[model samples]
Structures are given as C-alpha cells and as structure tokens.
Target chain A: MFLAFVAATLVITYFSARKSSGASAYFAAGRRITGWQNGLAVAGDYMSAASFLGIAGMIAMNGYDGFMYSVGFLVAYLTVLYIVAEPLRNSGKYTMADMLAYRLSPKPVRAAASLSTLTVSVFYMIAQMVGAGVLVRQLIPGVSYEVAVVGVGLLMVVYVVFGGMLATTWVQIIKAILLMSGSIFLSVLVLREYHFDLGEFFTRLTAIESTAPDGTKVVRNFLTPGLIFKNPWDQISLGMALLFGTAGLPHILIRFYTVPDAKTARSSVVWAMAIIGLFYIMTTFFGFGAASLMGPDYVQANGGTNMAAPELARKLGGEVFFAFISAVAFATILAVVAGLTISASTSFAHDFFTNVIHHGKEHQPGQEVLVARIAAFVVGALAIVIAIILGPGVNVAFLVGLAFAVAASANLPVMLFSIFWKRFNTNGAVVGLLVGLTSSILLILISPDFMGENAIFPLKNPALLSIPIGFLAAIIGTLLSKEVPSEDKFVEFQVRANTGLGSEKATEH
Target chain B: MNDPQPSAADKPPIDWHRIQRDPDFSALVRSKARLVIPATVFFIVYYFALPIGVGWFPEFMEKKIWGDMNIAYFFALSQFLMAWVLAAIYVVAASGWDRSERTLLAKFGYTSKH
Candidate 1:
C-alpha cells in the first residue's frame, strides 16, 4: 500500500516536471489552480502527521485537553480568511516576504521576513521528518529510523527540485483525500462497534479505566478538562498560539498565490475551512473510540500515544485496515514536508537570494528557479541530518508547538502591520521579526518543557507574552524611527490589496 | 511559463490615488470592515471562553446536559460549527464586495477578466 502511494506520487511528479519551466510555473503553478483544488491542497499542507497521529493520540491519552488543539486549529483559519488571504494574493507574487516588501524597504524587510520564514519552516519540517522516521519504523518492521528519515527527505527533495509547486500541490490534494477517507472509514467502524449509539459511546467515554504509573488501577472520566494541561495560563497561551499561528504560516500563506484572483482565494479559504472543520470534528469519534474501546493503558503498552488511531484500526478492522491507516499516515508526513520544503526554498530564493542579495533582480531568466531547487536539496538534507542526530526519543509535539509560537509571534505581527499600518517601515518590520523570533525561543528554553522543575516560565507556550511583544516592537519601532512614511506607496498597496487592480493574473496555457 | 513577457511589465499604469480617493472604494472598505472586525472580535471572544470556562469553572462546565456529554465537550464541538458558519457567512458577504469591486474597477476603465 505504501509503495503504491509512492509510485502514484512519483508519477504526478513526472507529469508536473514536464510542464514546469519558468519562474512563475515552478513557484506558483502558473496561478491556475481552481478554488477547490487549492482548497484541498491547503488542507493537505496544513494537516501534518502531528495533527493526524499526534492529536488522536493526545486525545486518547489526555482526553479533553487534546480536543482543545482541534478547536484552535480550525478557528485559526478565520484569521486567515478575514485578514491575510486576499491581501496576500493581491499584493505578493511568490513568498510571504513579497507582501512585506511591497510597501516597506525591500532589502531590510525581505531579509527579516526571509529569516522568520526559514526559521518557522525548518522547525516545522524537522518535526515532520522526525515523525516520519518514528512512524515508518513502527509501521513496517526492519526499517531503521535513520533510513526512514533519509528516504522521506530525499523524496521531498525530488518532488520540489523537479516538479516544483505543481507536484507538491497535487501530492497534498491526494493525501488530503486519502486522509479524509481513512478517518471517515475508521470513524464509521468505531461507530459500528457501538451500533451507532451516541449515548453508549458517551457513557463509555465518561468512565475510561486505566492502570496508573504506581501499578494501581484507576478510573478517570475522559470528558473532563485538565487531564494534561494543569495550569490555566498554559492552556490560554497554547490557545493564543494556535488561534493566531495559521495566518502566519509560510506554507499556508503561499497557497493563496496558486489561484488566479482574490475571489478565488476567498472561495478557497471557505472550502478549506469546511474540509478542515469536518475532519477535526470526526476526531471525537476515533479518538474517544481508541480510549473507550481499546483503553489508553493498552494503547500505551502496545506502541505508545502516537499509535492510538492505528491500534484502534487493528482492533476493529484487523491487520489490513492497520496497514492502510499506516500508509495514510506516511502520506500525510510526506505531503506536509513537501509543502514546507517548497515554501522554505521559495523564500530563500525569492526573498534572500534574488531580492535581498541581488537587489530584486535575477541575473538571468530561470535563475531564480534554479536557486530554489538547490535550496530545496540543501534544506531537505539538513532536516534529515538533524532528525537523525536528535533521534526518535525527542518530543515531536514540542517542536511543532514551538513552530506555531514563532509563527504567531514573529511572522504574523509583521505581516499584519505591513498591510494595515501606513506608518510601518523597514525598522519596524526588522525589529518585530527579530524580537518575536528571539523572545519565543528564549521563553521556551526557560519554560518547563526544557528546564523541568527549575523553569522560570510557567506557560508551556510563549505566545501569550511573545505575541504582544511582537506587536509592541512594531509599533514602537515605527514611532521611534526617523524615516518618513511614503503615502504614495501605501496608497498603491491599498488599492491593489482592496480591489485587485494590478495583481498578478493567471498565465495562459 | 510560455509567455516571455515578465509579470511586472504586463500591468498597465494604475491611478492608485484616484481609486483611493473614490467614495465607492471607501464604501467598499467600510462595508468589509463593518462585518470583518466585529465578526472577528465575536469569534475570538467565543473561542477563548472554552478554555476560560473549563479552567475557571470546571464544576459548572462538567454539568451534563445529555448522557455524559458535559458542557465542556459540547462547547468544544460547537466551535467546529461556529467556524463553518462564520466561513459561510464571510463567503456570502464577500460576493457583495466582489460586485462593488467590479463596479469600482469598471469606473476606472478596467474590466476584470474573471
């Protein structure tokens, strides 16, 4: 099943490679993707292995606290639809930095934005890479963690380097369909176990019996809150990060550029919200099914938390169902990493290399695409090496959470201020990005996740403090700087953003 | 990829100041802001209420409305519905904005291909 998925995706890459040529085609898929197509790709890019396997496992183990992650993930899209999507599609050409560089000083703003983009992407990519390794090893015996990591990494590199965004988008769309189908089937089987009785399902969930760490059997209600998150502040902070993070995600933002116009972008966001919202709601059935039917203790003893969904499949539908679910998980990881690699490489080539280093000019035609391909290879290799070094024991969930924190704090504030605030200048953009990036990392280092009992920060997620600091830095930096704000450029940007008067159009075939 | 013309050169010179000063453009912006700002604030407040309610008033939130379905679990499930409804409303509202945008562009002598 896994090999069949791999072969299907490679065939997609072959066709995409034949069609991809110029910078526009390679980067934005010729801006020809329909609303629903881009919507599926966006959902595919957004839902990672962490979301699929990790969230289900979390709910299976921690109950209500795990479901909190789902609420925040879907709500985060409103921020995207209302504020980020249309303006970004109208104003920017390639990457998130393109939007910022539209109104601010190109070199400084592009450099700062590119750094944040790479930081968020690398953090996100490493988590997915580590997850791929751990998951593949468990699903298929005789596969080492290091070997799995390298294989996934190389495959992503091949997708980005040869087929570019077109292949990556299709891979994600296909993965999304498979994931939704798998989840639906699993949810159905779980419901069938209870004869589709909601009362019985909820009754079982309320009293989940498990063995304690001290060898005592305990019965806990999975419906109650505070299972995993002890502190209210930690819960609120995580809520803030996830509530605002999706808007700032580089890979998610770049998908807006795949469509023809702002209206399509608008419709695509609606489609994504529908698909994503439904998928998250179904987690209740499968997650609680794992806890109520198989029991958390059994799941933990079998293969730990991340295997909750697959274990439930094995229990209810036998080995064949388990294998199919495992392959879907593998596809999930590959699609997410491919999306991340393209966004990172696009930022590096477009913002850092072509715009920042070469002063917004490519030395030759097709040079930007060439540079992006090289960057994709380098980024993939780096992720593989780091995942191998860190090994599978490192917490993949923490890294993904940190990526959201960085995005919410660093990328979001800067991008928002650039579009809405006329006084926002190069200094503000630079300061906002640097301060947000550094503060989130610093707070995480001192938090309980890293420092154990000696932790200074009480909250596990840093967005509660760091996001406010990011917005403040932008405001203060803009006020303190002596540079004069250019009204003409701001007016131009507003017109384009509002009416799509001079935005990039879809390329003709 | 087929076209040799760079993307930048294809765009005609736009009278940004004129569009910015137009009353129709202002109305369009005002209409969007009226819906988006309040809708955003409402959803954010509604979303945060879950964690706050669960954390601060666990006993109250734990009260079962229907067979083991506590307020906490029920509220979390409602968020998915809230998001979908809000998105549908936004999409519906945006169609009006699209019409206004088209009229504004037409006044400026540019016809949108889409």
Candidate 2:
C-alpha cells in the first residue's frame, strides 16, 4: 500500500510537471484549483506530523493539555477564513510578497517577506525532517537514520520540482484522506472495545492506572487539562501564539494563491475548516483512545508518547493495522515536507531572485522555474544534512513555537496592515518584519531551551509580547519614516485589493 | 466595453472611486464585514474560553457529567460542532455575496465565468 501510494503520486507528478511549464502553473497551479480541491489541499498541507504523532502522544503522556493544542490549531483557521482569505486571493500573485507589493515598495517588501518566508519554512522543514528521520527509522526497521532523512528530503525535492503545486496538492489530498480514514478506523476500533459506549469507554479509561517515566504507579485522568501549562497566563499566551501564528504560516498562506478568485478562496477556507475541525475532533479520540487502550506505560516504554497512536493500533488489531497507520504518518510527513519545500523555493526563486535581484523586470518564466527547482534541491539537501547532524537531539518544540511566534509577530501584523490600514507604508513593513523576527528569535534563544541554566525569558512562547511589538513597530515606523509611497499607488492597491480588479490575470485552465 | 479585459496598449480605465460609490460593490463589502467581523470575534472569544477554563479551573473541568467524561472534554467537542455549523452558515451567507458579486460583475460588463 505504501509503495503503491508513492508510485501513484510519482505518476501524478509526471503528468502535472508537463502541464506546469507556465510561470503561473509553476507557482500557483494556474489558479485553477476548485473550492473543494483547494480546501482539501489546505488541510492536507497544514496538518503535519505534529498533529498526527505529536499531539496524540502529548495526550497519551500529559492528557488534556495535549488536546488543547488541537483546539488552538482548529480555532486559528477562523482567522484565516474571515480576515485573510479573500483579500489575499484578491491581491496576491505568487508569494506573500505579491500582496504586500500592492501597497509597499516591491523591492523592500519582497526582500523582507522573502527572508521571513524562508526563515519560517527552513525551521519548520528542519523540524519535520528530523522528526521524519527519527520516526521513519523506528517504523521501518533496517533503515538507518541518515537514510531515512535523506530519502524523505530527496522525495520532497522531487515532488516540488516536478509537480509544483498541482502534484503537491494531490499528495496532500491523498495524505489527508489516508490520515482521516486511519484515524477514524482507529477511533472506531477503540470505541468498539467498549461496545461503542463512549461513557463506558471514558469510565474504564479513567479508572485504569498507568506507570509513568519515573517508575511510579500513576492514575492519569485524561479528562482534566493542566499537565502541559500549569499557569493560566501561559495557557493564554500559547493560545494567542497559535491563534495568530497560523495565519502567518508561509506554507498555509501560499495555498490560497492556488485558487482563481476571492470567492473560491473564501469557500475553500470553509471547506478546510470543516475537514480540519472534524479531523482534530477525531484526534481527541485518538489521544484519549490511546491512553485508555495502550496505557501511558506502553506509550513511554516504546519510544516516548510519539508511539501512542501506532502502539494503540498494534494493541487493537495487531501488526497490519500498525503498519497501515505508520504508512499514513509517513505520508503525512512527506506531504508537509513537500508543501514546505515548494513554498520556500518559491520564495527564494520567485520573490528573492526574480523580484528582488532582477527588480521585477525579468520576464524569463523558464529561468525562474529552473531556479526554483534548483532551490528546492538545495533546500532539501540542507534540511537533510542539518537534521542528520542535529540527530533528533535538537529541541524541536522550542523551534516550532519560535516558527509560529515569528510568523505571527512578523507576517500577520504586516498582512493585516497591508490589506486594511491605508497608511501602512514600506518602511513600516520592513521594520515590523525585522522587529518581529529578531525579537521572537532572541527571546527563544534566551529561553530555557537554549540558555538552560541562565535562561531569562519566563515563557516558552513569545507571542504575548512580540505580537504587540510587531503591530506597534509597524505603526510607529510608518509614522516616523519620511518615505511616503505614492498616494496614487496606494489608491491603485486599495482598488485592486478591494475589487479584485488588477490582480493576477486568470487563465481558463 | 464588451472586451472585459485590457489589451496591452489600450487598457480599460477603471473608475475605482465610482465603484466605491456603486451600491453593489459597497453592499458586498458591507455584507461581508457584517458577517465576518462578528463571527470572528464570537469564535475567538468562544474558543479562548476553553483553554482559560481548563487552565484555571481544572477541578471544575474534571467534574464528570456522565460516566467518567469530564465537562471540559465535552465542551471541546462542542467547538467541533460549532465550527462545522459556522462553516455551513458561511456557505449560505457567502452564496448571497457571491450572487451580488456576479450581478455587479455582469453590470460592469464582465463575465462571471461559472
């Protein structure tokens, strides 16, 4: 089944590659994805291994605190659905740069956005690659760590280079299907153990006692929520980060450009919300179900809590079910990695090279596409090498938080301003991006993860502080800077963004 | 006027300010904001309540409503239902906006492709 999936996707890539020769097709899938298609693509692209293995494991280990992450993630999409979706589709061409370029100066805005986009994608990709390396090695025996990392990296590069958005979309769609069905099967199987009685299932689950890592007999109540964040304030801050951060995610935002117009974009977000929301609710089942069936001892003893879902499958239906879910997780990682690679490469080639280096004057569509393909290879190689060197020992949790924080602080504020606030000039965008990026990174670097003994920062996530700074910096910089981008330009941008008048040309693909 | 597009040299002049005055365009914007802004604020508040409740009132959240299932877990599941219902409502609301947009486009001598 795993090899068949890989083969089918490769075949899809082959066909899409031939059709994806145009500049629009290369970067934006010719803006042809229907509402339902784009919706599936969005959910597929967005739900990573973290949601699949990490959160389920979190619930297995810590209980309700782990489930909170899923809630935050699902809720964040409302921001995307309501605020960002329409304006983004109406204005953007290829990258987020296209949206900002509407009002801000193309050179500086694209330059800053390119840097931010690459930063988020690189950190996110490295984390996934490292996790992929560790997980794949364990799941598929005899596959060395280096081999796992390299295999995933190369496959990701190939997907982006050949299929671009078209192939990547299908890969994600397929992954979404496999993951949802697998989770549903797992949930149903778990429920079956209690004769399909949710109440009985919960009663027995909480009644059971499990062993913890410290070799203590523990009775874990998967019902209550406090294992992760003891402090209410910290919980609020983490919630703020996730809620705002999702809108700024580079890979997620880029998918909006794949649809034709604002209408499709809006509808797609609704579709994504339904799919993602339902899947997450089932994940709550997966998490609680794992703890109930396999117990925390099994989860931890095998390989921390990351093994919860797979272990649960093994317990319920033996090896075949375990292998099936493992394959689905593998596909999940691959789809996310490919999605990240394409977005990062698009930023590097289209935004950085074609726009910034060539000052938006280059008309070489073929050259840009070639550059993007090369960029994908380089990005994949770098991520693989770094993941191998890091060897899964790096503190990826901190980096994920940092990625979301940086995105929320840097990207979200500027995007909101660019679309809504008329006075948002180029200086504000550049300053806001720099401030948000640096502050988030600096805080994380000093936090307990990096500084350890001498860490000064109190919180694990920095959105509570840095997000305000991002918004304030943009406002203050716009007021302070003497550079006023032309009024006529702002008017043109406003009209275009509002009315979808002079956005990218649509093809009848 | 029938072109519906700008040829390279002879681009159609769009009176953006006039469109701002056009009832169809303004109505579209107003209706969208009226629905979206309120929905967003409502969801954010409703969503944030769960985390805060779970964080501060763990004991209360742990209070079992049926069997051993706590109030918190049930509340979280309700969010799933709420999200789906909101999406369904938005589809209906968006269809109306979409219709207005189509009429406005046609009135402006543009084709609604679908």
Candidate 3:
C-alpha cells in the first residue's frame, strides 16, 4: 500500500518536470509563484509529520505541556515574517550565499554559507529519511524496515530530480491542503462522537487506571515518559528551537525567494499562518482523542503513545482512515524532503559553484542548473545511508529543532545585520556564520539529548547559550572588521533581487 | 529642477547656515521610520515575552483547557501562526514604493519595484 503511494508521488514528479526551465525554475520556481500558493507550499514545506504525528503523540503522552510544540512551531513564523521575509526577498541573489556574499567578499561567505546549508540540510534530510523509514514500516504489515528506507529514498530522489521546486511546491501545496483537511475532519468526527464532552473522556481514562498487586495506583499519564530528567525544561528548550528556529531554517527560508516580491512573501506567510493554526488546532484534538479512546494498555501494546493517532483511527475510522493517515504521513516526508533538496541544491549551485568559483559571474546558467540536480542526487544518497545506519528510533521533531537552532544562530544573525547595518563587512559576515554554526553545534553536543542518557550534560537546549552567542558574534565581528565593502555590490544585489529586473538595470544606471 | 544660486558675499567662515529642503525627502523619512520603528519594537517584545511570561505564569499555565491541553499549548500554537502571519504582512506591506524611495533604494543598489 505504501509502495503504491510512493510510486504515484514519483510519477507526479516526472510529469511535473516536463516544462522545467532549468535551475532557477527548479530552485526558486522561476520566481513566478503567486503569494498565496507559495505560502501554502511554504506551510507544506514547514509542517512535517513530526508536527502532525509527533505533536499529537506528545500531547497525548505528556498532557498540557505537550502542546508546547505547536506553540513554538506557530510563533516561529512571526519571527520569520517580521525579521526575514522582506529583507531576504530584497537581498538574496539566489541562495544563502547570494544574500551573504552580495555585501562582502564573495569567496569566504559562499564557502561558509554553502557548507552550513549543506550540513544543516543533510542533518535534516537524515531525520526525514528516518521518518520515512518508520512510516513505511508501520503502514505495511509485511514490509521489512530496510526495504522501506530504500523505497522512500529512491522515490524522494525521483521526486526532486524531476519536479524541482515548481513540482515540489505544488506537491507541498496539495499535501498541505489534504493534511489540513483530513486533520480537521478527523478532529471534528472525534469531537462529535463524544458530543463535545471532553470531561467525560478524561474521567473515563482516569477511572480506568489499573492497580499493581501492592495496591499502588497505575500512573498511566501519557505526557510523562520513562526517560531520566524528562521534565518541563526539556520541553521548553525544544519549544524555543521550534518556535524561533523556524525563522532561520535554510529550507523554509529559501521558500520566500519563490515569490516575485516582498509583498508576495508577506502574503504567503499570512496564508501559511491561517492554515498552520487551523491544522494545529485539529492535531490537538487528534492527540486527545487517541489518548482517550485507545487506552494506556492498548497504547503500550502498540509501541507507546507515538502510535496513538494511528491506533485511534484504526478503532474509529478503521482501514480507510488508517490508510489515509498513513498516506498523509508519507506525503509529509515527501514534501519536507523536496524542500530540503531544493535548499541544498541551491547552496551548491548558486552559492558554491556559481558565486564562489565563478566570482559571482562566469558559469553558463544551464551548466549550473545541471550541477545542482546532480548535487540533489548526492544529498539524497547521503541521507539514505545515514537513515539506514541510524535506524528509525531517533526523534525527527527534535532534530528539526536542532536544525532551526543552527539556522537561527548561524544564518539569521548574518542575514538580519547585512541589509540593515552599513558597517557589516565580509570578514564580519563570515566569522559570524562560522561562530554561530560552531557554537550551536558545540552547545547541542554537550546538551542532555546528546549526552546519551549519561546525565553528564547539564543543559538540554543550547539555544540559551547559542542564540546569544550568534548575535554577539555578528556584532563583535562587524565592529572589529576594518575593510568596508564597496557600495556598488550591495546596491547591485538589492536592485536585482528587489526589482526582479535583473542585474542589467543596476549596471545601466 | 531649481536653478543654482550663489551668494556673492563670501560664505560665512563657519558656514553658519546649512541647506535643508524637500518635503518629499521629509515624507520619506517619516514613512520609513513609521514602519521600521514599530516592527523593531514588536520583534523585541515577541521574542523576549515568551521566556518571561513562561517564568512568571507557570502556575496559571498549568491550568487545563480542553482535556489535556492548556494555556501554554495555546500560546505555543499561536506563536507558529504569528510567525507565518508576520512574514505575510511584511511582504504585503513593503512592496509598494514611490519614485523617490525607489531612486534612493536604487542609489543604494536595491531595485525598488520588487
């Protein structure tokens, strides 16, 4: 059943790529996408299964605090809207490197930005691949885990290789709509079945708690997991990364470039917000419904609360709902992977190959596009290998938080200061990116999650340390730099990006 | 364009007077400031408010809404909505620009129309 869905998604990609206009079309949808459509695609790209399944599962398992994921996810969009959307639309040449290198020397910034984008994207891609492996295994009763991982990986490569961003964006838009509609429908049905009696649901759940032979009550709350230091602190740090980190994510940020203007970027974000909010609300219900209906024994039997939504659907909607949820889960992986590939490809082609190597202007457009498509295959392959080794046990949602922290700490500071501050030089931009990326990674490594249950790491989230470090690095680096960039390059980037008339106009004037 | 005019009397050694003119430039300054100031203020408030609010209202947040969900859940979810909404708003509001603003932006190497 899952294999069939994967094949269909691949076919969609092949057909979608028939009219491809080469690299720009693949990377930024030819900058022709409408604001609302792009917004939906952006939302699609941003809202992964980690959100749909994980948030609900977390909520069902943890209780009131579990909803922090949704809060963090939603609020992060505001940060993107206010700080990034217009400026990125106005500054970036084609990728993160374009934005950073435009104001400073192209050499170091391009190399650094490309490496950062690739590192984060690959790390993120592994998480998605891991998710794909899990979903495929769970949905199909007979399929082995290895088969599922390879199947999803091959299908993802096909999707990206053929469809590019145009096909990917449309796919995401459709998937987002479907995911939202299905979630809403499921939430409503669950509520109607209970006659809006949430209290009754909880009351029954509480009353059903079993007792041990010693007479101690069975503590069956889903929110509190069996891990050491499984407290609210981990939850809050995870939330900060998801919320603010969304603003800085390379894959999501690149989506803004698809629109023709800053205004469209703005409009897309609005549409994305409305859809995301509605979907989250529905997910909360799904979580609660799964917890109440499936019962702790059943959940424990079927691999814990993470499987709550699927098990509950099996109980309520039966085979059809199960298939539907599983398909949606698969689509979530596809949409996110598509977005990640595009961002990675953009970094390689636009940032490294064209900008750094070509000194911002030597490559034929066609060749550059070809290099990017090739890079996509390589990235996909790497993700597949990592996923196979790591297996499917890792928490994808948490990794997404890590991705955001790296992006926010590294990309956001450089991006924010470059356009607004005149003193920002190339040296400053490069150091800032390096410092931010390094510090965040270091902090995360020492974090409790990375400590491997040893209780050695004192902190859970490095954001408390890294976010400030990123900001400070950018500030101090800029202050210490002596070389000021020539005014022409900054003007050139802004004009080409903002006007969409290309570089000719800037040079002509 | 105004014709160039020069004072016959040697300009004051200290250059006592400075040329200041153009209502449009003034208007541009005001318009730009209007957007920049509020946006900056809002950003600081939103980013800083959550950590502070979470610290201050932990007990209140512990209260439930529907079943297991609570105030913290709602706020967290709303933040995601806010992020996207804010992006959309920036794009919509910043796209339009007058000729002078365009020229000034162009002078700075940014194309004004996009």
Candidate 4:
C-alpha cells in the first residue's frame, strides 16, 4: 500500500520536472528556490534512510554512543555554516570543479574534482539504495530483495529524469517534513505508552533484556559498541569528520548555489541544522522507545538488535503506524537519490561539457540542458548497478559512515584552503585532493568493518590517522609549490566570483 | 605587449588601512562574526565535546534519566532541539549582516548574488 503511494508520488514529481527550462533549472532549480524552501530540501537530502532508521536502531542496540552519530551529523553543519557555506555560494561556478578551476588551470584539477564527485556520490547512492531494499523487504514481506531494488531504482530514475533539482528539492522538502513529523508522532506515542515515565521505561527495558540463565545482564546493544574509539578520541574523530564533512559533501555543497547569496546560504545552513537537530532528538526517543518498550525478546525473536526500533513501532503504533513510516522511509530514499543524481548531472554538464570539453566556449543552452538530463539518467542507472552488486550482505548505515569519512578526508581540506589561504596553488590542490581520497579509501579498506576477506587493510577507524594525513598533505603540498597563479587570471576570477562586476555579458571565451 | 608595472610603494594601491577603519567594514565584520562564532562554538561542543563526553563516560550515560531514558538518550534527543535553535539564531544573525556584508563584498569584487 505504501509502495503504491510512493510510486504515485514519484510519477507526479517526474512529470513536473519535465518542464525544467535549461541547465540551471536542471542543476540547481534555476537558482530561483526560496531560502526557506531550499532549507527544508537540504535537510531532506542530508537526512537519509541511515539517519532516519539506522540512528534509531543503533541507539536501541548500542546505548548512548549509537545516538552520537545523530549529534555528530547535526553538529557537522556548524562547520558548514561557519566556514564553507558562504564561500561556496560566493565562489562556486557550478560543481566543486568550478571552485578548483577558479584558482588554477583546468587540466588535472577539473578531472580530479569530477572524479572525486563521482566517487563520493556513487558510495552515497549505494547506501541509499541498499537501505531502500531493506525497508521495502520489511514493509512487504513477500517481495524478493531484487524486486525491491529494481522498484526503487525505477522510481528514483523517474523522479530525476523529469523533475531535475526543482522536483528533487521539493521532494526533499516534503520528505524532510514528513520524516520529522512521523518520528515525532511515533516518539510521542511511545512516551504515552510509558505514561511519560522514562525511569520506569528504562528499568522495564533493561529488565526485559536481562533474561540470562545465570542472570547475567546481557546489555542490549543500544548502539553498536564504541568499537571505533573510547570516549574522547572516539568523540573527537567522529566530531572531526562529521563537523567538517557537511561542507565537503557534493550534493549538500551545491544546495547553497540554489540560494541567492552568501547571507542566504548561511541562513539556510542554520535552518537546516535546526530541522536536522529536531529529527536527531526524535530519533533518540525512537531508539530508547524501542529498547524500553519492545524488549530484547521481541528484537531477538524478529531478527537481532537492528530491528528493535521498527518492531517497537509495530508494537506501539501497530500496522497503521508501520505503513506510514514505511511510506516516509521510501520518500526519504527517493528524495536523497534524486538530489544526488541532479548534483552529479550538474557536475557533468558544468565541469565536463561546458567548461573542460568546450574550453570556456559557449554551447547552445538547449544542448547543455539536454546533456544534463542525459547525465541524470546515466548516474541513476550506474547507481542502480552498484546497488545490485552490493546485494543484501551490506549494512546501509556502515556504508554511510564510509561516505562521510571519504568526503571529510578528501574535499574539506581542498575547499577550505582554496577559499581562505592564498598560497594554496594548483599543484597543491591536486595533490591534496588525491592524498585525502587515497588515505580515506586505504583506511576504510583495511579497517575491520570492510576488512577481513574483503578487507583492504588491517586497522579500523582511520580518523585518528587519515584525517591528519590529509590535512597535512594539503598544507605541505601548498607550502612546497612555487608557481603562483597569474595576476590577471586571479583578478578575473575575483571579479567574476566575488563581485557583481560585469561578467553578465556571457561571452564565449 | 608588456605593461608598465607599479613600484613597491605604489603596489596595493587601494588604501587598505583606511578601508579597515571604515565604519561599514567594522560593522560588516562584527555582524558576520556574531553568527559565525556562536555557530562555530556550537559545533565544537555538540559535535566535538558531546560525543567525547558520552564516549568517555559510557557507564554514566547508560543509566536512566526520566525513567528508561538515560543521559545518552537525552543528549541524543536534545541535539535536534539544539540544531533548530542554532538555525533560528543563524537566520536572525545572518539577515542582520546581509546589507553591510554585501557592501564589503562589492568593494572586494562581489558578483552574482543569485
């Protein structure tokens, strides 16, 4: 029933998107999006299935630390709000490639920026798709996993092909509101079940999980154990990646472009943070609500700890609540995927076709628009293929962590240095991006999470090692490089990016 | 074609010292900083400090709060409330800075408000 509603929603959204006028509309809702509207959309895009479902599940399982992911995610936007939001809105040409090319020659920088965008986007999409598969299978018990994947893929493509960013952003805005409302409603219901007595609730929750033969209390994993780090180090590493990662995500960064100026961009992050924070708080209740009310026996009977929150909802809210949440979960996945495809398409259209391939030569606006639409379809298809290969073995939440780590390691340093530090030359930008990307990937591959038979390395949690390495690499690379950019080129870039000086006469260079 | 270059004294032709002293520039910096600093501090604590607190004091965190809701649970839930407060703060603070900041940005070669 919920799938039917989402399919209908996607169809209507897709048709609405078909009216996108040009590349601007396709890429960034034609930059006509209102500040409030874009704020909701950004919240929607950033808050994925992992955030909505996984955070609650983790908290239910791991205790306090699992819920930390939610706090880290919301706080991460502070870094975005303070450092990157305005600069990105002030300086970006289109994709992040524009920012990189702003300070240096196109060549390898454009290529590298484009590559980085693709790598992060693909990983992100896989996590979303996998989450969709899991949710769909749960919602409709009889449906095969493969069918769920195909259904989600088709729905996503339909939305991206027709709606562009305009459709996608609105979908995100709606999804964000729905997701927040749904979680709050469920939390309220859960609280009501315990008569708002949280103390009794915890005792009951723990007592239920404490049923061992020897009476040894089996700590119901409220969140996956702090296997990553202990106390301060774990918090610091999570904080570093999440705090900085928001600014680096390609899709999130591009949302600033949909707004009017630096002020608007800044304002949007603040709004996004508030909306995101509210949702995270709601997730904690859902997590604990699941733990206290549903009990360990129910969670273990269903599957394991991950099912705690969802089963708790089933117990409290029953079938109707389950159906509503199931629909919202689908909407969450769709909105995020649509935004990702639009961002990727914009990168292809702006960075590759118009800028690099054409070498600043102007193409017909229609031709550019066509290319963007085509690229959206291509990205959606590629993500679908990746999702199929990943299959059922993957955990959606873990994959999201990987995406956050990679984005923090690679893009944050380059973007930050390019804006604030003048000495950061082209060579340094290229090297910094490469080092960040390589190190994060290397760390993830070898870590215990993705390690073992498929493991690329032996250590887990690369934050302590990889993050510093990336930052140092960027700083050192910039310091060692001697070739300063041409004064004239710098002046032109400054004029175009920083001032309202007359680049309005769009000339084919 | 080679263009004549300015001497060292003539370089940095704009009076940066005068610009710095301008009321408009000072107001611009003050207004922007108000929003930027609080937001930065919040990130430092919420993302950096809160998680560390929980991670370090796991035992204390796992204990119940109102009933079943523990300190960890409360922190996680309160986080979203904090985000909304920060967002509202950002809107009010950023809007105040917009006009003056724009003036500074123009002086520095600002373009494309859209």
Best by TM-score: 1
| Candidate 4 TM-score over all chains jointly | 0.85
lDDT order, best first, reads 1, 2, 4, 3
The Cα error of candidate 1 at residue A264, in Å, is 0.6
Give the TM-score comparing model 1 with the true structure, all chains together: 0.97
lDDT of 2 at B7: 24
Against the native complex, each candidate's DockQ, computed on alpha carbons, is 0.52, 0.40, 0.16, 0.28
Looking at model 3 chain A, which ten-residue stretch has the lowest summed lDDT? A500-509
For model 1 chain A, give the 10-residue run with minimal summed lDDT.
A392-401
Best by DockQ: 1
Tens-digit lDDT track of model 1 for A425-467: 8899999999999998899989988899999998899999999
Quality class of the docking in candidate 3, CAPRI style:
incorrect
Candidate 1 chain B weakest lDDT stretch, 10 residues: B1-10
Choose 1 or 2, whichever is better by DockQ.
1
The DockQ-based CAPRI class assigned to model 2 is acceptable
- Best-first order by DockQ: 1, 2, 4, 3
TM-score for each candidate, following the candidate numbering: 0.97, 0.94, 0.84, 0.85
lDDT of 3 by residue, B12-112 (tens): 32111110123444455456457657865775466545544555556675456777544554555556555555555554455544455566545434443
lDDT of 3 by residue, A121-160 (tens): 9878877787777777777888876788788777777777
